[model samples]
Target: MNASADPLVSIVIPVYNGSNYLAEAIESALSQTYSNIEILVINDGSTDDGKTERVAQSYGSRIRYFSKENGGVASALNMGIEKMAGSFFSWLSHDDLFVSEKIVRQMDALAHAASSESICYSNYYVFTDDPADTVPISLKGVPPEHFRYWLTVENVLHGCTLLIPKAAFTTCGTFNTSLRTTQDYDLWFRMAKKFAFVHVPEMLVKARSHAHQDSHKLAGTALKECDALLSGFVAQLGIDELKAGSGQPGAVSYARVAASMRSRGFVEAGLVATKLCIKHLSGESPYTKVLALFVLTRGALMQYITKPIKGLIPPSVRSTIRQWLAGGTKKGPPGAETVRGMGLKEKFSEVYDKNIFRGSKSRSGEGSDLVQTAVIRREMPRLLRELGIKTLLDAPCGDWYWMRHMDLPVDRYIGADIVEALVAKNREEFGSEKIGFECIDLAEGELPKADLIFSRDCLVHLSFADALKIIANFKRSGATYLLTTTFTARTSNEDLGTGFWRPLNKQLSPFNFPAPMLLINEECTEGLNMFTDKCLGLWKLQDINLQ
Candidate 1:
């Protein structure tokens, strides 16, 4: 197509501390088959090696290079938009690549779209350092009315795949610089409300995933911003009875957003968001309101009630009582005996004193303890050394049986349990200048700071509500890593009543733990005839992404 026949398309490349992949991204933009195109590189004050500036200069007049004070990705893109000479605007990240026909394909798709459609986006591929991990992602185009509702729930459109008409910004406005991570999402959400979005079925972009991406580093801030942005939009679209004559999509969307927030450890914010969801659903959707209220109450009780109850009891009595009441006692089958309607501490304390319960059947040193102890001894030292963990806290240090066998490699190690008797025994048995023991009620007491925390066979014993509180406390304690044995199975979550024993994949499902956990090693007590998939997993508190 001739230059005049085809409208000029401006590609804005926002450069940050991404010199490592800047050249590759620029080459892809410059090599596009679409002739009527201009490439603009906006340097947002990168303090990395001077390679980014030098590389831009190497392109010379072929591409326009603009530098400004360090604002952020949104600021750089806004500046580029201000100086763009093309009628259509598209953003290309410094680490993402555009196929040679990406611009041409989008323009062709735009020809078929309605005049009101101001944005055209195509399917894209996600790739990491490993080529085998690359996969194509597709999105279905929806009408403006439903698109706004979709964006409120989540961002499905990739910014790199979008080509926005210059006129769209007049009504939709430019990127919000105040937002660090959700700038693209926020802008897209706003634009979707006013303009229709057309999705091209073809995959034309390669979005790279790496460790240094802003989304990975600033997850918590991004989640808060997303919540704030969604809250504003949902509030503006009031759910008055006249407006929502039928079922209210706004209320459903808000409920989904609230659930997402809760899954990410934003418990308080999740409750507030859910309340708004319930308000919108009040007169519109009776069934939805009931479900939302149930979810909200369950989550609230888990964090507020169950968590505090666990902590109020001494650690020594905590595990013993739970085991005794649950009938997981190694002594024998618990029979029809029950410990309900009694004081938790008093009943459990009497049971512990009388040796009514030997211990949790799972932890009863019936030779299975040797296997767990050996694994801990083999793994703990290497993990501490590799992760640079200086201090360690072992919660629910159940009798300190297996711990006594492990080699303590950390600079300092502390064993803690709710059982005062167990803590005293541990201190008498192993306390030293480097090794110490404390009586800690994990569910309720203040936790000491440590580089790493090891929680084993604890969460399964508590209700799902109490487990979430303890996990939240672990994050708040400023611990870098969390090591725990998660009980996962092939089937659905097993309801142990107070807490549900989940499959490995469901680990992230309960209470939106702060970080995504890594399954470092799987230990099957199968040799001992156990029916649980007890695997040791590691979670890096620093690596949990906001989304």
Candidate 2:
């Protein structure tokens, strides 16, 4: 462990608030069998209960600690890098956990590729408290030539998984502090300019999924920063092309410019560029046109199909959708009288009792029942198992009967409801601890932490903004998986179709809505709208891990 002879690896960690996981990260760094390491932790003016000094003191003199007024993660990282004395440099996010072999494995890969490549990265596993979750793997066999192309489309590198030579840093430069988010991508792009980047193809880090991480809280800011970075890069590329006196623009350059403009809230500019790109490609390159068409078609479909649902959705739901679109917060109200009035509870209860509770006896007379509750009960367990989830936080978990009927692992369950009567009934039936019923309004108050948080058939009753807030709250609580249902069928003034009648035959008795009666009035035809698409979108597992 000689400081001078050993190939010192400087592990720089930039810290902000909520450093609960900092100790784990530092211990992982220290416990690395690769002893020749200098752990440099920079505290970026975190306002969280003296987390900086606490972690530093705990580490004693084993690690170097530097504290500065809040300047942002990039600034803290830059300062850390400048003060480092290691031959190789790497960064570990304050909240992220590194595996014991992380440094040694990364170092080995870098040393092996030292002559040919300047940077190296390894795969990392995503870990959450929820047992049912899958770790997403990074793409393989991505040639360095296509690295820029891949980056322009999506970020492939995880910041915590990267290891680069100090010389690489000297060449590529430190992160841009001015940029709020995507500084890592900005730095990576700069590094790619000079160095060949390679993936180690080994999982060497354990990235934590938790609430309060920068990615979840400052998603909007991050997106904005990414746009700024892209704009700068686009400008640079344009200048370089101009200086080279090349009249023909590069395809990569055009794509990057268009992408940056799109990211920076310049959709019209992006569309124009995309059209020009299509024309250019149509004449000179067919492959580019194909890619453009694929992207365009997908975008158009999403906008067109979801537009109706987006419009019809109550304001609360719309707000949530907007937040998600902005990559900000997510979550919605747990209970509202309007939502309760939807008769969803009764519908769910009846189905549960008939199929789940009574089992085959309840369906002995009926040949087959293929309804929503039956579908939910049959599919939910399979989905949960497939996702590798063992725990569930059934927020506003209406009644314990669903749990009993679903027969999921009820050992680790928290059933919350705003209605005191429902909570009392659940507690009385299932006992307080086993079902753990709580009388809390998720819409108005804080939520408990859980691995997989969900409230079935609850989104429609909430305004969009409240829904977004609920989602954001779940994310903050560090839930890795979410599964909630929303109403998507359109109610219109038209004759009941034979096919529709057969499907909803049982529920037809309760169909007394105004729209069904309005079929005789031609004037009300315009008000009829369909909400046919039920969207089930999840954050890509990789994005969750990276956060």
Segments of candidate 2 deviating more than 4 angstroms: 1-4, 49-51, 114-117, 129-141, 227-276, 285-298, 303-433, 436-457, 461-547
Top candidate by lDDT:
1
TM-score of candidate 2 on Cα atoms, chains taken together: 0.58
lDDT of candidate 1 over 459-486, digit per residue (tens)? 6545565666677777777889888765
Which tens-of-lDDT digit does each residue in 1-547 have in candidate 2? 3445669899998888646668877887888878889999898898877866797768889999988999988899999889999988889887676778888787777667745556777787665433234255455635555555455545556888888888887777888888776778888888877887877888777676543446534543544555555545444443334223222344433544454344333344445545545544545466655665655543433233233233455544444554354333433121211233333345334433334222333221111222224434534554465466666778767655445565465346788766566677778888545457777656555666666675654544343444455555665666776654422122222222210111111111232211110010001100011122232223321232211
Runs of candidate 1 exceeding 4 Å displacement:
130-133, 238-257, 264-273, 277-547
**How does residue 52 of candidate 1 score in lDDT?**
84
